[model samples]
Target: MNNQNSWKTLAVNLLAERTLLIVGIATVFTLLLLYPLFQMTPTLQASPNPPGEVFELQKDLNDKFPNSIHFTPFLLESLAGDVLTPNVLLEFKQRRQELFAKDAIGALAAGDLERQPYLVNYLDSETGVLMTGTHSILDPIEAGLIDIGTTLESASEEEVKLAVHRLISDPKTSAVLDFLSRHATHTPSTAMGHEIRLWVSPAMTFSVMTDNQKLGGGGLEIGVGGGPDVIAKEYLNRHIRDVMKEGSTSYAIWGIAIDANLEAQDEGKTAGIFIMFTVIGALLVVGLTLKSYWATAICGVGLGVLMIWLKGISSLIGLKSGLVIDLIVPIGMISLGVDFAVHALRRYKEELNKQYPPRMALKIGLSSVIGALILAMLTDSIAFLSNLSLHRSVIHFGSAAAMRFLLRSPF
Candidate 1:
């Protein structure tokens, strides 16, 4: 062999041994550690699940010895009867305020219409819309005309409402209300009943059940009536802000991010396994083709290094975890590249075997197949690049593959 070829042979042998050992160790570690982790993944996921009920589970470590490494069972038992979380407190306050508001509006309506400061706006507390007439209001207290006198102040909400209804129905007090109650609830539904409208508090919830699903989204009129109060707006915003800071929402967010990562790790593993196997197949072909252990080893070493480089780059971009074959394709690339070189050399070796020495055989083989080797690679490149026209990502894939050809090129 030429002096140049001799150096090539030595370089290929030494590098191949070190690279192969690294690859083997890595494969073993991946199989032992990573594979087990991958397998245990399902159970790991199952362990932290059952999320939607995190509120019911309050875990507080019992610390009898604050300085020592000691602990006790969750102190949830102590919190049982008094387990009112922020959410419960919020709901209680909201319900309580609604009842209080309902009572206030009731008292306003139950009193004598001839007395009390009139509620100026006919407001729909639910929708925040307002009108001029007081009697058109839904809540009994907004009616300006009801004459309960001071009885409304002392009476229960139910009792106050009854007094207002009685006053509205009294023929002497309200000829128009007496006529309206014949067809419906004494509650006024027009601008003419200004005294009655002032009593309305529009925050009541209403729902109608139906047999027809098509009619479900149709004809719904919801409103809000309490007068515009800037202080309430700020308080409501604070409550919503507090809800967002709760632990359940935080856990749910972290759980989702972790679940995505686990899925990605699994995909990368599958791609890595398949690529490893493909490289092994290429190594076998190199073994069968080359007579020199050093020459065959060159192909394996170059392919392994290329595999590591491609994997490292893909991982840096996080593509390896999410992308399947595309991420692993770099593994098969080096072997494929050098296989062409080996095939070219092999053919010339057979021809020289008849009458030539190793150097003559090697030179002739390289000269004979260099063109064909490069031709095959060009063909492969064209085939891969053609797919780039279909997808933007394929363009990057083609470049990566073309790089493998360059890295794997042996004289």
Candidate 2:
């Protein structure tokens, strides 16, 4: 009895008399801890890396070929017959014009066309945007048209056909045509001649790749504006996809960075909607159970603080959030938070019903459940922290979750 009374006195002193001190310390700690929030860069991967041998080999290859360059491919499939028809080619040409306009980021240019057909970097001096050049069948097609003394705009159907044929027959341009043909095959037609069939594929694809300019002492300059070139390229790729999709054609734009950004955007949108619904549900549940608006508001505020602390702790330790971690952590925290709040509130109400004063009731309610709450925190932390060695993503999730449990013990 004496021990229980002493425990109740401690709870009263800590929660009631020193509430302002606790709040001040938590606010300061959270502010300091949240420094890493601005610097966090989340990475989403399908799965962890392969075993050590394969992973190390891949890492070595990356180190050796650091400037090999990566490309984003934008595949365009015509819903309306051959992709090489005069009308379709003209439309595609127009789209390219929009994509590579002077006002835009620009496209790849050939440094020495006569010696070797290769792309060179084109940087916009005014915009500080570096556009990695693009490789497409259209490049060679345009060259063939120029060789034959006509452009896509002025060329008739016959002229365009001639340009495509010349593109295929020429040794200089044939390699580009062959590479394109591999990805976008000709439409099968028994009636059409073999030459005509070979030149009229229903699909074509283009790729864009940028070069990072080397700075003094082996430093690299990606672009101004913290990778404006990166941003411009993503915008450029998305624009290409949008243009391709305009006329009922099937389109897919993919690159390492592009796809990752797209997936992150999609997941972020989904997470927003999910969080909205979860908040609403939590609010409704807490409000209905507590039957007190103040209590519900407090619960809501507490949940928000818990989330901030969770994120702050994870950020401090340099953990990046993924889709799985984003989804799981909130659900667990909300459920546990609501459970803890409801139990303690109900216990306090019970003490009040017995005619205990508010202070005594608060003390008794908190003191009675403190042991159970601490035990729950320990067990949950252990369970989550146990996953530390499983995978990189698991490590992030586990550490964040364990931090959340520890944070809850104070509450």
Top of the candidates by lDDT: 2
lDDT of 1 by residue, 1-411 (tens): 575566445444444446568667656644454433333322111112222444123211212211111000011110122211223223323433343343244422221222122223333443233433222222233232234343322434443444445444454334323212122323543332324421222111111111111111111111111111212222222222233223332111111111233344355557766777777777777777676687677667666555555544444333222343344465557457666757865776686777887655655556556656666767776676666543323544555566556545542
lDDT of 2 by residue, 40-109 (tens): 6343322343247865675576456554443556666555656676677677666655545522433332
TM-score of each: 0.35, 0.72
- lDDT of candidate 1 vs native? 0.39
**In each prediction, how many residue pairs overlap at the backbone (N, C-alpha, C within less than 3 A)?**
34, 2
